[model samples]
Target: MLNAITITQIYVPDQDQALDFYVGKLGFEVTNDMQFGPMRWLTVALPGQPDRALLLEKPGPPSMSEETAAQVRELITKGAAGGHLFFRCDDAYKTHAELKAKGVEITEEPVDQPYGIDFGLRDPFGNHIRIAQMKLG
Candidate 1:
């Protein structure tokens, strides 16, 4: 039976740069970093959440042909690959300030919503990300 999600993947043109952005800028921790023949299996997780990891995949061999990989890469660069991630934070405004001070791109300022306060940002690879602080009932 289905239980929990283990991992989610997003394609990047360069693994090292993605690693730096996710870990260095966003404070994610490396869950795995190893090689599988020509492929590098790299994964990361939020500081205390190791049960689920985000795979920083490269668009290349072992998955698709070079021609297809090139097309994927092009789409990713244009931010049309449909990659997105949503995150919950303890404090939306604070998190936004912290990330902005770290030089992370701030695509939107925090705004109050029916659910909570939320904001958006884009990863270096053009993947859209939204972070929010929710109110408890």
Candidate 2:
């Protein structure tokens, strides 16, 4: 049986830009950055979480047809291609301020929700990310 999720992939138009956004801005650490033939293997993980990671990939042929890749590209540009990534933070308000100060694009400011205080943002590739602080039960 599978024990845990190791890596999740998010397609991007450019890996270099994604790297800068995730590592330079979001404060994730680089787990791997190497070129395998025509494809580059780029992965990042949170500084405190070493097991799970996110892979920054480029849409292309072989795995997806050229037409399909183009469609995905368009969707990504429209911010409707991928699912949101939810992150649990200690303080949503503070995190939002810090990320915003660092030039990260925040789509929504922190607000109280039934579950917690949360905020939303988009990665450079247009992937949605929601950070929240869970209320103690």
Per-candidate clashes come to 0, 0
In candidate 2, stretches whose alpha carbon ends up further than 4 angstroms from where it belongs are none
How well is each residue in 1-137 modelled by candidate 1, as lDDT tens digits?
99999999999989999999999999999999999888999999998899999999999999988999999989988889988999999999889999999999999899999999999998998888999999888
lDDT of 1: 0.94
Which number leads on TM-score? Answer: 1
**Each prediction's Cα lDDT score?**
0.94, 0.89
Which ten contiguous residues of candidate 1 have the minimum total lDDT?
A: 73-82
Task: Return the TM-score for each candidate structure.
Answer: 0.97, 0.94
